[model samples]
Target: MSGAARAEHRVLIIDDHVLFAESLELALSLEGYDVRRLELPEEGGSMATIRSLALRRNPRTVLLDLDLGRFGDGMNLIAPLAKAGINVVVLTASEEIGRWGGCMRLGARRVLPKSGALQQALATVRRLHQGLPVMSPDELETLLDAWARERRNHDEVRQRLDRLTPRERQVLGSLIEGRTVRMISEDSVVSEATVRTQVKSILNKLEVSSQLAAVGLAHQVGWQQGV
Candidate 1:
């Protein structure tokens, strides 16, 4: 048989719940899907690992959990995978209106809460295979609204960055590129102390905590385009 003929519909599930992953794997297996489960750690899973696994299975769809274990937030992985051309469906129990809306805008085909029935999730898979949009009508509307609002936010972030001095923007650019403070300082002809201060100010102005968060936010806002 050819690859698609011999292969069952492949599925890559990213979740920290071990028993749940096994259960899901077994369930999908019964449905003739080749399922691979990655149980994320308590501190969250690695994007590199998830991406590598996806490339390996090349699943037609992904079942992603918004909460990995304890501190693992799904926000970091959702947009990245979606941007990479993977079809992702967020499987989470979080019903927060904003989060649900945000996930859809970030390229999730569907967002199914764990509290819902397993049959619903399986139904979603069927819809995906049938080339039908997976999310519910309500969810679709929410996603569209969120996408529009997100565009506005991007414009706002751009305006904010435009107000920054050229040096500050340069520092932000280097930071987004994953350069260290020392490296940015050396490359930008600024002292390490000044680089540190600039980074601090940038974070404060952006209202983000870490460099990764800032980088992600910047990417979402189109500030770090072409990266």
Candidate 2:
């Protein structure tokens, strides 16, 4: 495509985190994207509003959040955009187990954690422009391991994940979906204490002080692929 076409790639940031979302919008615009920023939707903005944007602007890609202030999830918007033939890339801070797989299965074209630096996100967008999978060898390894461990015991999996786990891998997938610790405990059939310990361990292993930090780290890496 010509420079104009490439420049026409509309990028929408649908995040509830106003500051970060605005920063992303500014950054992406600086990087040569036709960018639009939508503050986290209240009760998830009307699907009609989104459809209108997609149909009118026909953005080349969308930067979505998995969780949007409990109003609606970025995942909820993926299918509609996909049906409209728009490309979607997740730009959330969710690190729950199985979330990566779930987003992909739900038809998101790609997932890039906002924790990842702007350069990395830009690289992925560049690849998207070129019609290629953006994952590098290392990112791919982390992603696959993350997807795999969701099915295994947390302790058993953490040992393996430590080597190169996806940054800030979230608690079990269900927990991040607004489920309670007791609920997750009930679902996973583990004690609430055990769940808390696992969450702590995951936080420690990832070297983050909070759950959001862990989630953000999933996308940020000091290393580059094929270096």
Candidate 3:
């Protein structure tokens, strides 16, 4: 439980999907690897519950899914499982490269998109079983670098959004909804000049010269109008 698994060929599947997990378990079991799968618990899956299951089972490798439905983000368990010396292999339906990049950054030995994942997953597990690196140093570098670049851009967008006052954000949101300054002014029962001023302040705080640019920035960061 603390270091290596009690059994070298044992693997744990932690996906919520029943059919996929069963197919994988059957496949692995046929290949002479001991396999166990976690079903969605009575209450629902959770990071805490998944972590406890892994610790209790102490498999050499864990096959994880990101969107656990009721369980929430599976990314939360990657670091802890890796730290406990269990190899984490993320198998996800999401096609986003950012999410794949995040898996490696969080210590997943391999990440497989659910599309055509069977062969890739088997190969990864085989390498891991042999104590060989699943990803080359260069491939690992590429994924980690992509993760870093994405994180940097996300942080910048969040910082710019954080600079806006509540009123300015509401004004920006109105703009996002395609409301003109006059319309926003009428809704707020303020003068056109006042709404225009707020719009200008939003542009300044967002470091964009035009209202369109400000709106685009807000949208990029997933900002919403505050109540």
Candidate 4:
């Protein structure tokens, strides 16, 4: 069953490291899977690219790198890929264990450190494709605990975001886009002083001290326009 499954499985690698992606593609191909590679997409377009590729290739699994250098975090692609019915196995250089929790909650099937052996990574992908659990009992428990904590943090962040009034939310959207007080004021036909006051209110409601901090917090909770 495993051998036949391996022959039919398609794996897509989305990593910005050209050399590493090439090597992984070769390795997977040698292991009897149809493998494809794609560098990270430009900012704000990764989700669409992943959806389109998944629709075209219909890969059974995706090996994703969380860090895409200048492109941005590959974590953003997990949910969309999963929704497209592709199993995602995270291949990351990130040492922070907390990030693993986030990835798993976002629909990744497994997380493999880039420091691990290539053979082990390949085996994990195979297991996932065969509908097997990748984590041991202990690891599953740890992941559940970490996921619970992350959920709590996410809820708190959402609560803070809910404190903003409609106009303040608009100000925040402008702020995240790198718009200055004057620019936002002129564009919205509001006074500069009014923009400043709204900015202060946004900061206070978001529980951040400054505009930069507010922007950072907004990103942490996956805040975007109309969301």
Candidate 5:
């Protein structure tokens, strides 16, 4: 390829998987793209490095890995990269479809599962370079809607959780751990009546009619104490 073609095909990969990154770099380079993968530090902060690079030599497209090891979060880098007028094509091994929605909402041009073949990835890059859309507008809109719904559900869960006192949170945690009300009361050295009152409060605060429902919600949303 000519120097001008390589210059126009500049691409950056911010992935920690050394072997994969090197393979992608070689593949892209072979296809005439001037690809470079960020050399991650031992501890992380890949977003900082990406921001620094964007200021110096921003590429036309970025093939980002969702998990960056200690190189900080790749998810957090999407908005800023897109805001910089760079097209972002997320490459992730995650099976979570909701996460792909988050990526699209965060301004990713495309979210591709890493399970795909290298030829598919190469084809995606070629399409982008030729000024083509990787996915349809309808597909993009659907993912964006999914993310919005997920965000709403998250905020609602958080708000309900925030209403709990520390004791209530502890009780909720115990419930999640499969402790019975009587057992919890015995462990805390409290009366059975007091434990029942706390259980009622927990149900009220969580807005769930049953203890099982509350526990299910906690696990589903990946609830953690102190949020």
Candidate 6:
């Protein structure tokens, strides 16, 4: 490609998989895009690196992945990259359709599953480069429906959580952290019997039949450490 062509079209890939990124870099380069791949760091400071690279390279598009080792989910980068006027296309192996809506809501250009055909993935990127919509009408509708159902489930979980007392909330947190009833009793300065009663109450309030189900509900509602 000519220097002017390279200057106009650049693609950056931020994925932790080195071999996959290198292969994608070669493929895109062969297709006349000035491609660069940054394998995400296993430790801290990836966001700063990404910002610096964006400023220096000024890539027109970024192919991103959600699982970035210890750096955490790459969804957090979507809004910032989009705000900088760079189109982001999520390339992930996650089969959850709700993630597609979440990425698009954060201004991603498209979400392409790694399970899809390589030629189709390349075509999607090329179309996005040309400012075309990647999703067909049926696909868009399916994603929206899945997103709506996810939102509804989230709301219900939050509502159920709100019904728990402060003490119950603390117990729920400990349970979600995989603590045994005896462990929770020791930490809370309560007897094992008291902790068992509290656990039963928690299960009833959370509308779950078992401790495992309650823990799953807690995760669905975005429970975190120290909650």
Score residue 117 of candidate 1 by CA lDDT: 36
Q: Lowest-scoring 10 consecutive residues by lDDT in candidate 1?
A: 1-10
- Candidate 4 regions off by >4 Å? 1-18, 28-88, 93-99, 102-109, 115-119, 123-134, 188-191
For each candidate in turn, the TM-score is 0.57, 0.55, 0.78, 0.63, 0.79, 0.87
Quote the lDDT for 31 in model 2. 72
Write candidate 4's Cα lDDT for 20-51 as tens digits.
88988999888888889874565565556655
lDDT per residue (tens digit) for residues 191-215 in model 2: 9898777777766775667756654
Give RMSD (Å) of candidate 1 vs. truth. Answer: 8.9
Ranking by lDDT: 5, 3, 4, 6, 1, 2
What tens-digit string does per-residue lDDT give for candidate 3 at 1-227? 22234235789998888888888888777666778997668775567987887878888899998888777889998999999999999999987676678989888998888888878888888778878888888888887788888779888988888888888878888899999989999999999999988888877777889988987877765778772
For every model shown, the clashing-pair count is 0, 2, 0, 0, 1, 0
Question: What does the lDDT come to for candidate 1?
Answer: 0.73
What lDDT is reached at residue 129 by model 6?
Answer: 68
Ranking of candidates on TM-score, top first = 6, 5, 3, 4, 1, 2
Candidate with maximal TM-score = 6
Give the top-scoring candidate (lDDT).
5
User: What alpha-carbon RMSD in Å does predicted model 3 have with respect to the real structure?
Assistant: 4.7
**Model 1: lDDT of residue 23:** 77
lDDT score, candidate 6, position 50 = 61
Give the Å error, residue 82, model 1. Answer: 2.2
How many pairs of residues collide in model 1? Answer: 0
**Against the unseen true structure, what C-alpha lDDT does each candidate score?**
0.73, 0.65, 0.83, 0.83, 0.84, 0.80
lDDT of 6: 0.80
